[model samples]
Target: MRQMHGAWPKDALPHRIWDESYMELQHATRQHEFVTSLYVQAKLNTRALLDQVIPAYEGVFSDLYSATSLQVLRAVCKDKWMRRRL
Candidate 1:
C-alpha cells in the first residue's frame, strides 16, 4: 500500500498491526459462521458456535488465501452452540 501512497510512517506501524489482526479475527469468525450457515441450508438441525472461538484460529495472513493461507476454521459450538452440533 505504501508503494503508491508514498511510504508508511513508523508511528502508524502499531495501528496497522492492530487493524490487520482485527480484520483477520473477524474473517475467521465469519468463515466459521458461513460453513455452519451452509450446513443449516442442508437442514442438519445442528448447533455449534464455532463463530466465537475464544483462543481464536491461527494461520497465515495473506492477501490471497489460496496462495499462502494455512488456516482452517474449526467448527466447535460450545456453550449454547453445543446443543446444535450435528
Candidate 2:
C-alpha cells in the first residue's frame, strides 16, 4: 500500500503524460473512422457513376475503346477472375 501525501501536485507529470497519450489515441481513432467513412462513400459513388456511364457509351464507342472500358470497369466493380489479372 502507498501512503498519500497532501502536498503532492494534483496534476503530476505521469498523469499528464497518460492523459495526453489517451487524447492522442482518441483523436487518431476518430480520424481513422472519418477516413474510412469517406473511402466507403467514394466507392459507393464510383459504383453509381459507373452504372450510369458504362451503358451510355458501350456500343457507341469504337471496339478497342469499348472493350478496354468494359475490362477496366469490371476489374474495379466486380470480383471476377479477370480482376486478378489486372
Candidate 3:
C-alpha cells in the first residue's frame, strides 16, 4: 500500500488528465444542448404569441418564421407605423 501510494503521484498525472478532458467535453456538450433547447423554446414561444396576435399570417406564409415572412411583417409594421404617425 505504501509503495503504491508513493508511486501514485507519478501515475496519477497522465491517467487523470484524460478524465478531466473528457469531463470538460461533456460539460461543453451539455452547455450546447441547453443553449439549443433555449433557442427552440424561444421559437415555439414566438410562434405561440404570433398565433394569438396574427393567426391569419400562418395561412398567408407557408412558414410564418421565414426570412420573407419577417421582411413582409417588417414592411407592414413600418407602413402601419407611418400611417399612424400621419
Clash counts for all predictions = 4, 0, 0
lDDT of 2 by residue, 1-86 (tens): 44446755554433344577899999999999999999989867765675585655445545423667667766756766666778
lDDT of 1 by residue, 1-86 (tens): 33433355544543434577899999999999999899776533211222133323232333312333323332232434666664
RMSD of candidates 1 onward, in order: 19.1, 11.0, 4.0
TM-score per candidate: 0.29, 0.46, 0.65
Name model 3 segments beyond 4 Å from true. 1-18, 81-86
Query: Who is ahead in lDDT, 1 or 3?
Result: 3
Pick the winner on TM-score between candidates 1 and 2: 2
Candidate 1: 10-residue stretch with minimal lDDT = 45-54
Q: List the residue pairs that clash in candidate 1.
A: 46-84, 47-84, 47-85, 49-77
**What are the lDDT scores of the predictions, listed in order?**
0.47, 0.66, 0.83
Q: Candidate 3's residue-wise lDDT over 1-86, tens digit each?
A: 33355446544554534577899999999999999999999989978887887888788988877999999889988998999999
